[model samples]
Target: MLPNRSLSRKLKIQSLCSNHKQQSSLCASFSASFSSSSRCRGYDDTIPNLKIGKHTRVIFQGFTGKQATANAKESLEWGTNIVGGVKPGATGEHLGLPVLPSVRSAMEQLKPDATGIYVAAHQATAAIEEAIEAEVPLIVAVAEHLPLHDMMRIHSILSTQSKSRLVGANAPGIISAIGKCRIGFQPLPTFSPGHIGIVAKSGTLSYETVGSLTRAGLGQSLCIGMGGDVIAGTNFVDALKVFETDEDTEAIIIVGELGGTAEEEAAEWITEYKRRTKNPKPIAAVIGGFQAAPGRVMGHAGAWTGLGEGTSESKYRALENAGVTMVDHPAKFGSVMKDILAKSGSNFKKMEQSLAQQRRSFHSSSSPLRPQASRSTPLNTRQQRSLHLSVEQNATILKNYNINTSPEPDQLPKSTHFVGITVARSARSPCIIAAPTANPHQLPHRVRRYPFDYRSGPSQSAIKSALQHLQLDSAPVSSKAAIVKLINSLWTMYKEKEAITATVSLALSSENDDLIIYDSDLLFDDAAFKSCKRQQDIHSLRNLTLLAPTDLEAEAAGIMYIPLETPASLKKDGKEPRNLIGTLVNGAGLAMNTNDVLTLRLLKNPQSAYPPTTSANFLDTGGKATASTISTSFKLLLSDPRVSVVFVNIFGGLTLCDMIAEGIILAFKEVGVDKPVVVRLRGTNEEAGRRVLEQAKLPIRAFDEFEEAVREVGRLASGVEAKTGVTEEGDLDEVLV
Candidate 1:
C-alpha cells in the first residue's frame, strides 16, 4: 500500500516536471532512460530540495574590499570552488581570482553557480538585483540594516523574476563542515561532519554550539546562519524542510535568539509536517538572551524585544508545545540532541528502511536514473529588448553609481523596442514628461517640453495665456485640476494612438504633493532616468509622477534615495572649529542611544564651554561589520576634514569585534591618523577587539566603559589632550590618572 502511494506521488511530480520547460529536456531524457519504478527513486534524491553543495562554484561580489579579499583567500584555501570576484572599476585585476565589474559579466566569464555578497547596506539592493538578473542559484549577503523597502524590492525579484535562494542580508552564510564547503565567514575549527543539522540567526552562538557538538562527538551535516536582520532572506522553516529531506542530516538543532518569531513559525511548519507524514525527525533548540532586558537590543539587529511576540518565553512555549526538545542554553544543545536521537532509534531505523526501499525499487527496475548538468540558454534578442531598457541607458545608470560603464553607446548593441514621448500642447498650456532617449548611443538629442512659454513670468500667467489662445480663458477648472486632466488625457492618447507597451507619463502639479526619491532598489538601466534618476533631488520633482504599467517594477529600478539628516560639521568664521563627532556603531538602536546620551549629557553639564548644540552623524555598521568595512569607514572619516574626533561603538554578536579591530587597524595604516579617535568594543570577543587596538600603538584611545568613551570625545572636542595608560596585557580599563 505504501509503495503504491509513493509511486502515485512520484508520477505526479514527473507530470509537474513536464511543465518545467527549463528542466524538460533533462526530464524527458530521464524518462527515456529510467523505468517507471526507477523514475520514482530518481525523484526521491531531489526531494531534499537543497541547492548548494561543496562542488558549487561561487563568485564574490565586492571582491576588492578588505573582508572579501581576506575571506575569499580562506575559502580558496579550504578548497571552495571560487571562480572569481566582482569589483566595478577593478575589472581584469586579479586578487587571487578574476575580478569583474558586475555579476552579469562574471556570469559570462566564470558561469559561477552562486554569489557571496560583501557590500554595505546602501549598495546591497543593487548587488542583489544584479545577482538575480544574472540568475545565480544562490546569494549570501553578509551585511545588515537593509531598509525594509529595499528588502521588499529584493524579495519581489527573487519571487517573480528568478529562482535563486537568498541566504542573508545580515547573515553569516551556510557551512557544510562535513562536506568541507562554506559560503560565509564561519569558525572552521569548531565544525565537524556528522548527522546533526544546525540553523541559527546568531553567528557567534552557532560557533559556540558547533564547538559543543564537535566536543560531544556529534558532527554537523550543515550549519546555517539565517541572518539577524528583520527581513532575512531565508528562515527556520526553509532550513527545516531541507534538513528533513537531507540524507546526511539525521537530526536538527535550532539556536534561536530572544527577538523574532522565526522559531514559532518553524514550530508550526514542523507540527503540520509531522501530523501529515508521521516521519518525525529528532529536533533540539536553544533560545538565547532570555535574561536580556526588554526594549534593549542584543548584538543582532533582529534581537530586540519591542512587542511580546518575539520574547524567549513565547518561543519556548511554542516549540515545547510543538513537541521539540528545548535546551536552556546552547552549551546543552549537543547533549539534548544526542538523548533525543538515542531514544528515537526505532524512528530513525524506520526512515532509513523507507529511503532504502525507494532506492531499491528503482535499482530492481530494468532502467537507470542519472543526474544531468544544467545549461544556460540566452534569451532571444526581441524577448530581451522587450524588458524596457536599452544597453545605453543601463550604462548611463551604472555610471551614475560610480560603477564601471559599458563601452561607448555606439559600440553597444541596439534594441528594437522603442517608445515615443510627446508633450500635449494646447493654446492655453503645454506639459513636459521627461524620459530617457530611445538610444543614447545613436541619438544624443533629449526630448523636453514645458507647459508655458519660457518668457512667461509665472505658471498662472502661462496657463491664462494658453487658455486665452484656446478660447477657454473663462474655464471653471483650476490650473492644478486642468493639468491633471491633461496628463490623464495624454496617457490615454499615447496608449491608443501609438500602441506603446511601456511609457513614462508625468503629471506636474505641486498642490499637496510630497517629493519622494527611491534610489537603491528599483532604479536600473533605462528605467532609472524615466523615474527620478535624472533629477538631482526628489524635492524638485515632487509634482511629477512616473507612469508605468507596474509601479512596483519602477520602484525596483535603482532610483535615487536620500536618507534623513545625520551628523555634520559646520564652520564659524574660521575661528575655533567645533567638534564634528563621527560615530560608527553596529546597530541602529545603539547609534540612536549613543546620540541621545551624548546630547543629554552635553546639555546638563554646566561647566561645558561649547553649547549643547553639538552635532553627530552615526555611521551604522549594520549587524555584521567585517574588518574591511571597518577600515573603509575609518578612512572615510579621516578624509573628511570636518571631523575633529571619531567615536566607534561596537556591540559584536555574529560580527566579531576582533574583526572590527582589524579593520580599524587597516584604516590606521592606509591613512596615518592625525585626529583623535575613541573606541568602545562590547559583546562577543570584546577583549580580543580591544587587544588588537592596543597592540596597533596608533593614536586610538580604547575604552571598556561606555561613559568614559563618550567623555573622551567631549574632552577631545574641547581641545583637551587627555591621555591614559594601558596595562602590559593590553587591558584598556586599567588606564587611569
Candidate 2:
C-alpha cells in the first residue's frame, strides 16, 4: 500500500473529531468574519468546479486569424461551447461564429466565460490585458516567445484587483475530456472521460501522460498545461487547490521537469493538505530532465537549472518526502497509478477493475491514438564577442555601474585565506551564497545561503547576520567590511545587468585583513539582451567562439535549438561514432518526450548494427512558425556532419502541418538532403499537410501513427528492425499488469 493511503483517512477522522469539539465553542462573530474574508474573488479563489465544462462559454481573441479559425472549428466540432470571438477592427462571422471587434464587445454581446488568445507573441500582452480588462473568468494565451519583461508586467497586472485567471503565455491550454470541452490544442483522440486530474508544465508531456492513462483505462477529468516560462500566471499550487475541490477528480498527476521550485511548492501544499483532510487524494508525479546537465537551459525558458535545489533530484526528493508517489519515467506514470489505486482498498480496487475492463473494450475497437509534437565605451565591442567577462573586465564593468571592486593584483596585500561568494536568482527570490574556498569549480556543502527581497536588495545588516550565522564573526573587521561592500556591489550588478547569476572569488589578505577579488563569472539574462538596449551594449562583449556554431545558426534562423551531444563526445579512439538522430519538434515537452522514447528504444536493443543511438539535438520551430523557419531548421540539422537522420514530429495547434510539410519540400529544393528523413504530423491541418508531403514526392517517409514513425526513425538510425513493439492502440498490458 502507498504511504499516505490509510494514514490520510485516519488523520481526517481525527481532524473531524477535533473540529466537532471546537465548533460548539466557536463564537458567532468569528464564524461570520471567517466566512466573508476567506473567499475573496481572485485567481487563487477556491471556486469548486472551476475547470471548464461542457457548458462554459468560450471566445477567441484572434478570431479572424488562420490559427484561431481552424482551432475554433475543432472546438465547435468537439462540443466546446464557443459563443463568439474578438477580432479588433473586424466584424461578421468566422467559422459560423460571431466575431466582435474587441474582448469587451464580445463580453457585452456573448458574455463568454473564457477567452483563448491566439495572437502573435508581441501582441499577446495587449490581448491578455484586454481579456483582463473585460474581467474574463478564464484567459488562455497560447503565444510562445513572449518577452520576459512583458510577462513581468503582465504578472504585476494580475497581482492587482483583476478577476481574470491567466493560463499561458506559451501554454498548450486546457481540456476537460469528461465535458467534451477543449480550450487549447490538445490531441483529441488520446483523451477519454475518467477520474484522474493532471496538471503539467509541459503540454507534450501532458499529452504523453494522458495517452498512457487512457490506455490503462484511467481517463482524465481535466488536464491543465501551465505555460512554461520564467514567470507563469498560474502555478502548480494554484492548480492543486482547484483539483482538491473537484468532485470528479479522485487522483492527481503532476508532470514537472528541471528548473524552478514549482514542484517543491506543490509538495509543501500536499503535505499541508494531508494534515488537514482525512482521505486526501493520491498524487503521482513524473519529473523530466533527469539526464539534464547543470546550468543548461533545456528548450523552455524556465527549464534552466543552476546551483541549489532546482535540480531534478531535489524536486523528486521533495515530492517523495511529502508522501507523493514519484514515477521514474513519463511512460511509467499510468502503471504506478494503477498500483496505487489497487492498494487503496476495496472501493478503489473495484474502480480499477472497471477501468481495466473499459481499456480492454476500448482497445478492441478501431479508434487510434493521436500523435503529440553592459558595456562601457570601448569595452562595448569586446563585450559583444565574449559570453562571460574576465576578472578585470568584470571589475571594470562593476565600477561603471556604481559598484565597488577589489583592487588590481599588484595593489592587493598578501593573502592568507580564500573565500567564494555567489549571488543568483532562485525560485522565489535572489539568494546570496558564501563558502570558505578558493577553488571556483567546486561548491562546498557547508556554504551559507541567505535569501533577501529583490526589490529591497541586500542590506549591510543582512550581510552581517549571514556572516555571524556562518560563524565568521571572529574574522577581522576590515575583511568583513570588504566582504559586505563586495556583496552589495554584486547585488547591484545583478539587478542592473539583469543577470541570472554573478559569482566571484575573494582572497582575504593577512596584512590589515583586506580582501581582494581574484576571479569572477557573470551570466546575464539572454532575454534582457534582446529586450533592453543597456543589456545589448553589454552583449557586444560576447565571444562568438565560446558558443556552439549550430546554436548561433539556429538563433539567426529564428528557431529554438539545444544540442544534446557534441560530435567529440560521441567518438571513440578508433571506432566509428554512434549515429545521431536529429529531431525537429514544435513543442518543448514533445521534443523532450521524443528523445526519451527514442533513447528507451535504443537501450532496449543495444546490439544493433548501426551502433548505439541518441538524439543529436532538441529543436523546436515554435507554435507560430512559418514555412521558411521550418526550411531553415532542416538546413541547420543537415549542416551538422554528425547527423545521420532527421525526425520531424509536429502536433499542429497554432502551427499548421501544411506549412511544416511545405517547409520540408522547400528544404529539399534549397539545401538538398542526404540523410534519412522521417515525418509525423498530427492536429490542425494534418490532412492537408500529409497530402502536401505525398504530392511533393520527396525522399521522406511520412506516418500517421506516432509510434510507427518513431520505430521507423529508430530502424533508419540503427540498420536493424527496431524492437519494443507498441501497437497503434497503445497496448501496454505487459507493463500495466
Q: Give Cα distance to truth, residue 674, candidate 1, Å.
A: 32
TM-score of 1: 0.46
Best by lDDT: 2
Writing each residue's lDDT as its tens digit, candidate 2 over 1-737 gives 11232443343343334323322233233334222233233334423324889879999988888878878888898889998888898889987789898888898899888899988776888789777767788888877667554564454344433256877767888889889889888877667887789999888778767866766767789888887876677778878998998987888999887666578778878998999999898999877665443345667877764433335656777788899987544445566777787776415533342444324212221211111110011101111212466667677787775545564466443332233233322223455666555442343233445554354566454566456644457877777777777777777777766665676666655565555665566766666555334477668877677777877877787687876654343468855455778889887767766665565454333432345666777787876689899988988888766678999988775678899999999988888888889998866577899999999888898876565576677677765543444466654212211
Clashes of 2: 19
Tell me the deviation in Å of residue 653 in model 1.
Answer: 8.5
Can you tell me which runs of candidate 1 are displaced by over 4 Å? Answer: 1-50, 296-299, 305-310, 346-737
> TM-score of each candidate?
0.46, 0.73
Clashes of 1: 20
Question: lDDT of each model, Cα atoms only?
Answer: 0.53, 0.67
